[model samples]
Target: NQIHSPFWCPTTIETPTKKSEFPVPPCSTPFNHVNSSALSYEAQEVRRCLRQGLIESPEMSHAESLVLAELEDKLRAAVGTRYPQDD
Candidate 1:
């Protein structure tokens, strides 16, 4: 009888011998591009704000807060789809 595992597995078992044995299709979507661009822009803005002294004034603090919040929301939305909702 063969032992089954939900975690570790023996490497001696059946394994693909050729790279082509398992083909992976290219995954590209317009949403991915847009999301990447938005994330990049937000990161740049955050860095710029930090370099200019984010806490120099109340206005700067507010602006930086907004940028950070937007970045956080975008990241959560992007990852939330891959995870189940909490109760």
Candidate 2:
């Protein structure tokens, strides 16, 4: 018997922007390093939906709201504590 794990690497290694980069702190979520204002409009809407309790399905919970909140916190920490709504 033989066992194998799948691993991959890209031929091109593009530099990371806060929007598209690997995290400086790996455990953090995506958008954790992006500016709320700098984020794409779609990102902003998703954040809004997450915070507004518009989740459509029972599979999603308020706990997800907490995760979204924490992600926003980490993003704020990275980008100097801004909230898009405050703009």
Candidate 3:
């Protein structure tokens, strides 16, 4: 007969009873609320550009292409993929 102590067992680990909490400081940047119904095309384009990542190739789907086309001309120029052939 063989017996293994709890300290020597690999699966008998004990966890802490209470977890520590992190206190996050409030954001330093002030927030300016804009009306959703008053968003202009250019504002929308800028929002879209900021949210999307750079596409490296033209192998994207038709839906993706449409979304890309919706981006502002300056944004497209920055991405350097104005058209499918540009990839």
Candidate 4:
């Protein structure tokens, strides 16, 4: 009969407990979150407010996104699509 060493068992393996050695650097520039409510048509934020809904075509969806973003900014709320109006 042969006896095995105790070091080879699963209990001997050390699990990593430390955080990433090279952590991702924080964004140097803060996200440019625009105040949609204060914007007018002239201050069109056509890319800031888009939720980017699922569309049949990527191009179509992108165009709709741009339009919706502009509308949301100008109107200060969701301006298109049949949403429940605040009654």
Candidate 5:
């Protein structure tokens, strides 16, 4: 009922936390942009696995071998083209 209502409600406000600041430092050494050796190593390892898969495909069903072959080809192409060579 309107006769039983309270006159005022208490409220609380939270204080803001201090933020840590960072300043941009001048560039010293040129940052190394690419790691060609690592990329090539990984690609070669994947290629090796794909070759092994091809060899073992004879034990798999015809449809499975076909799918594996298609995937291997796509991955091979991607690895070959995606990385840059060290000049």
Candidate 6:
């Protein structure tokens, strides 16, 4: 019995037939060291959905919401480490 995340919808996975719809952000500093082409298929899918606003939409599934929360926590932690707060 294999378990899968609720966010995994086979119907939603499709090859892009046209030009890449995922737009690169204007500020690329955060992604400078990361290679987009080296990302795994699953990561690419998540990136595509994130760029499309599907991940943050009102209709987002519970699994997506959880994933988003985790991503946010990771981002906060990374930022904190990069620029420590003075208190």
lDDT of 2 by residue, 1-87 (tens): 212221121122344432233222233335543333333444666777778887643445678878988887887779897768757
Q: How high a TM-score does candidate 5 get?
A: 0.25
| lDDT of model 6 at position 16 | 46
Off by over 4 Å in 3: 1-39, 54-87
TM-score of each: 0.27, 0.28, 0.17, 0.21, 0.25, 0.27
Lowest-lDDT window of 10 residues in candidate 1?
A: 3-12
Candidate 2 TM-score, true structure as reference: 0.28
Q: Which stretches of candidate 2 lie over 4 Å from their true place?
A: 1-59, 82-87
lDDT for 20 in candidate 5 is: 35
Number of backbone collisions per candidate: 0, 0, 0, 0, 0, 0
Report the C-alpha displacement of residue 41, candidate 4, in angstroms. Answer: 30
Tens-digit lDDT track of model 4 for 3-49: 22232221122335533222223444543432222323213333433
* RMSD to native, candidate 3: 21.6
**Range of the 10 consecutive residues with the lowest summed lDDT in candidate 2:** 2-11
Best by TM-score: 2
- Weakest ten-residue segment in model 3 by summed lDDT: 1-10
**Ranking 1 against 3 by TM-score, winner:** 1
Overlapping backbone residue pairs in candidate 3 total 0
Model 6 — which ten-residue stretch has the worst lDDT? 2-11
Q: Which parts of model 5 have CA positions greater than 4 angstroms off?
A: 1-59, 81-87
Pairwise TM-score winner, candidates 5 and 6: 6
Candidate order by lDDT, decreasing, is: 6, 2, 1, 5, 3, 4
**lDDT tens readout by residue for model 5, 22-41:** 22234444535322233444
Q: Please provide, for model 3 over 5-75, each residue's C-alpha lDDT reduced to its tens digit, 9 standing for 90 to 100.
A: 33222223333554333222344455353222233443555566556763332344567777766665558
